[model samples]
Target: MKGLYLALAALLVAVNCEAKEPPTQVVYRFDDHRSLELKGWDCDGELWYTDTQKGIHSQVWSQFYRIFTKKFIHPSERYMAISSWGGGFTVSKDYGKTWSGAHYSPGENEPNGDNRPPYDDILSFTVVGDQGFLQTKHRLYMSSKPFDDPRILPGGPGIHYELEDGVKGDIQSGSAGWAWGLIYMTRQGLKGTIQELQTSWKDLPDKTPEVKGYTGWDHMRCDMDLGK
Candidate 1:
């Protein structure tokens, strides 16, 4: 009888230990030089972009603009999209070591003084479900297979093209499958919006209404905690 009790207690302790272990987390770290550098861990907990020479090609590192990752169509398949400072975009089926460029051309609509490829200088890009979305100053584009072709998403005029009063905008995606549209301070106030991409964007209600009295705002690098 004592032996049976001891075995039951050991089993309970083993279950408790397993329950106390934390789940794996995906982390993204960004650094900026002339362009931007991004490194992260995938769901497997393997560190990506660690190799200096073989991690990312030289051209990609120098002109890197932004990098986005998502579990698009398949929950098991992770996809990464990277854009350039000048104009083009690329995709990595694996975590970002290798890439296949997108065949997009802005042509006559290309921004002035941006000498890189026409498809490179993306203002914001993200993947929601099976669809990938890209926003330039002028248009919003969507694609399923991003490397093949991307078409313009309707309702471009409804979207805010640029930040008001010289403010900057950063678009980030949440693991819950929503995009957070964060705008820096403007003449009016600091604004934030949430977009599901099913409909147009909407303003997120101000949480701290009591806090006020800022004249102007400049860009600042701050860490964002994306909670599961």
Candidate 2:
């Protein structure tokens, strides 16, 4: 009887230990010095993270972020990433018990995304199921990935008639899940031309007096460090 009681006590202790275990963490750093993290947490189809006080947190509305990324954590649910202090990010698949992977927000993720040039501090997004839009440091991209992972939008469809006969432009779309009218380095109050998705430079509009970049912008629900 004594041995049986000891076994029960041990089992209870083990369960308690598991319940109190801390969450995992993931962080990212960018050349632009914008960094962020993701702590595995969730709430109401949204991602929960740690704030300045280091307390667990979640967004008042994560659906808006769904337009871009699917990594939002739900309340009290097991997540693989979370946010951090001093405005950074982190990630961990094991729920904050441990963590790995970091990145700089609005950093370059080229040869894998759209034609718009690289930009920074992309923190706002909106997604609906498999269709959504993402606003990063430079510009917005489109995708149809799971709520946990979304892809970038492609360029418009057609040819640059002004160019050589056989030359072609990138595939751009206006679909909701894959439609992003705004782009990086675009001159405010002026419109720029869309070339191939692989080009690096853009011709400024005639009326604009030197285009400004990332002027007066902010976002939420992104890893911040690695998410951009």
Candidate 3:
């Protein structure tokens, strides 16, 4: 009886430890080095932030696990990656309710992305996404999705994406009063500003206009590792 109890105790301990262990997928998923974060959904921000699946992780995930984030985040279909530049296009088909993590890569043949992405400066681009309106230097040029070439938007030195109603996500929501993708310059350097855009079922014209000071390309740079 004592021997049996010991064996059962060891098994229970092993099982508990296994349950507590972080899966291999999680190990890969949490390796986030980007400044911008994709959030709001229930996956605990893991889809955008980590390579790890919630549980059922693996060294080489199965097909189901392979596109798990892509599937769960179903971005392009609903959300639009409203950016002033290339990387870090957060689209939400659900109308600011939730964000779709689906993303677009500049691919192999782009102005700054031909074999070398326009600067390896992929943001989720908190590096460039600043607050000033139509600041060109901060504006980046990498073809957006569905476009084979990179496109340029008027903004600051760093890149910023603007998610609005009826872009690609077909979401009918608003950013409220907070404008999406407005980065505030700080001691830490340029970062992506996150604000809720006002969503309206009907179109609201720009009633009033204002100017805000934001960083510009005067501070633009490329990732040395992924030399542009």
Among the numbered candidates, top lDDT falls to 1
Give per-residue CA lDDT, model 2, range 111-206, as digits (tens): 353334332444443322222233455544432122211112344343223435565543333432212211222232112233222232233222
Relative to the true structure, candidate 3 reaches a TM of 0.24
Q: Model 3, stretches more than 4 Å misplaced?
A: 1-7, 18-90, 93-95, 98-101, 105-124, 127-228
CA lDDT of every candidate:
0.33, 0.32, 0.26
Tell how far residue 27 is off in model 2, in angstroms: 6.6
Candidate 1, run of 10 with poorest lDDT: 181-190
Better of 1 and 3 by TM-score: 1
lDDT of 3 by residue, 1-228 (tens): 999999999999889865652322221211122112222122122222222222221112111212111101112222223332332344333323345333322232233434323323432221111211111222322211221111121221222345554333221223221123322111111112121111211121112123234222222222222211
lDDT of 1 by residue, 102-149 (tens): 534222223462222234334444433323455445544443322211
Query: RMSD (Cα, Å) of candidate 1?
Result: 20.3
Best by TM-score: 1
The candidates, ranked best first by lDDT, are 1, 2, 3
Ranking by TM-score: 1, 2, 3
On the 0 to 100 scale, the lDDT of residue 83 in model 3 is: 36
